[model samples]
Target: MARSGKDTDKRIKTGRGRTASQIRWLERQLNDPYVKQAKADRYRSRAAYKLIELDEKFGLLQNASRVVDLGIAPGGWAQVVRKKRPKAGIVGIDLLEVEPIEGVTILQMDFMDDAAPDALTEALDGPPDLVLSDMAANTVGHKQTDHLRTMGLVETAVDFAVQTLEPGGAFVAKVLAGGTDNELLKLLKANFTSVKHAKPPASRKGSSEWYVVAKGFKGRD
Candidate 1:
């Protein structure tokens, strides 16, 4: 494969006490444009560009007042939300401890915890106008198991969004290769006026991840 001009000739030296996989990861990170851009922008991770691209296409952050971020470790997505919606009340939950960001609330806990939903809403002080889930299960190296676990996170995120999003609000979640399954797709379509899948430009070409953007919440019956 031909390397892009942006990659230059940067290469990692082998035998640095790093395993082959770790060395490959480091080299890819070194050559990734998004990583460079993230450093320049002072965002926490390259994943921030995924949200930025999604927002540019979906307008997810423009009118948001209260927002919830699921799996907000490293605080990249939350940082983007704070930058774009400066006044939006942002609360995030994750099993990983995150360094705090100004104008954002960080909760170190599992979102699957029974108390999570209440804690998130309480922190926001209102139903969120936008809910973003970047959560992915820790991969177990078994493809089927990994996909199922990640989808479980997506399912929970969708349930929370449907239960608490303000009318006409939006929900965005990371889904795997097949996107939402039939039942989850039906639930999203039934609850929101628009449900679509997108792979933002920032997403790596080899990745199976996609974003489900559901907008115009129809409100509870």
Candidate 2:
């Protein structure tokens, strides 16, 4: 592949049996500034910057006492939380095994399991003031199927947040580009004082992901 006139661009040589898609992915990763920054900062993944940007814009981590991280794989978001709010109780659940992060309680289990919510709450001393969900269903290639599955996870995360968050709390979850569906948007608006969607600069321009941030949790009436 030819460089687009950038002297610093890194190129990946495609070896035997490597698909074009794999080569493109590697090339993009090699050229991504965030990926380089992540290595320099010792963060687990580039996704950490997405949360950092969101926190800067929303003030989500300030004075947070308890937090729940849904789909906290590779522990990047958890690491950010530990750094920003060192004394906060943080519990994370994911199907993938995450190497231990000090001050974070990791549960290597599916967040959709019926018992998962209870386990998360038990790990914390009080209701979570900040609930973060980066969960997205594994893509199955079909666009509609992938979108539906991801939205299902977001809806469930919203339900969990409504049922578990403390008053004046905040919930942040990744939603697709078209933003939350009408029903989900209604639910969030009804339950939160402010609901807005944002795509941080850290998110790739080609990606369709946007984050739905709902703040000021209304207590269960």
Candidate 3:
């Protein structure tokens, strides 16, 4: 994957003993027009735009589509999915409980386990049209540890998506920029019509994370 950085916002203006890096991050967010627009638009987080950007680019969601969302905490991506397809079906599961939305049915469960895919499958009346995962482990400040953990989540999602998705279904999940396990990429390439590693404009300029979109599965099961 390619690593790209946006121009840093804000030179040192104040907060004389604070770390320059932390200060720059906060100022960048504050000055970001999208940040202000997201708040005004009532999006749960700025991360919602990543989904918005993807949908704009790929035409991912269709009317009356069935969707399964993993790691759906705070409901930002789920919200975007719903907004795009008001008539679509969405089932979201997360380790953290989310407030109910009228159109979305949520299960509070850890999706990293073996049984998690079955539970999501059981909830669905039929095969899903898209499986979207926005999961990431919060950084422990150890680069290698964080990278491995995020890769584990991505790998798990890909495994379940292989089993559950209908042919031509799309799978999207978040992966950090560096240290993806190559074995997993090989698997994705074999099954997906095309696999792309893309960073949506909505992702923070400083975030290490990017999303991988694997489209048009051939359906192994």
Pick by TM-score: which candidate is best? 1
Q: Compose the digit string of candidate 2's lDDT tens values, residues 1-221.
A: 12244548777765568888888888899888888778877889999999999999999998798999999998889999999999999999999999999999999999889999899999987899999999999999898999999999999999999999999999999988799999999999999999999999999999999999999998899
Provide the overall lDDT of each model, using Cα atoms, as 2-decimal numbers. Answer: 0.93, 0.92, 0.83
lDDT of 3: 0.83
Off by over 4 Å in 1: 1-7
* Stretches of model 2 off by over 4 angstroms after superposition: 1-7
Clashing pairs counted in every model:
0, 0, 0
Can you write out model 3's per-residue Cα lDDT over 1-221, one digit (the tens) per residue?
Answer: 12225545555578788887888777877677677667877888777888888888777776438899999888888888888888888999999979987798899989976778888888867888799999998789999898988888888998888888888899999999863468988888888898888888878777888888889988875
- In order, what is each prediction's RMSD in angstroms? 2.4, 3.2, 4.7
Look at candidate 3 and give me any clashing residue pairs.
Answer: none
Query: Which clashing pairs does model 1 show?
Result: none
- TM-score, per-candidate, Cα-based: 0.96, 0.96, 0.85
lDDT: worst 10-residue window of model 2: 1-10
lDDT of 1 at 96: 92
Q: Considering summed lDDT, which 10 consecutive residues are worst modelled in model 3?
A: 1-10
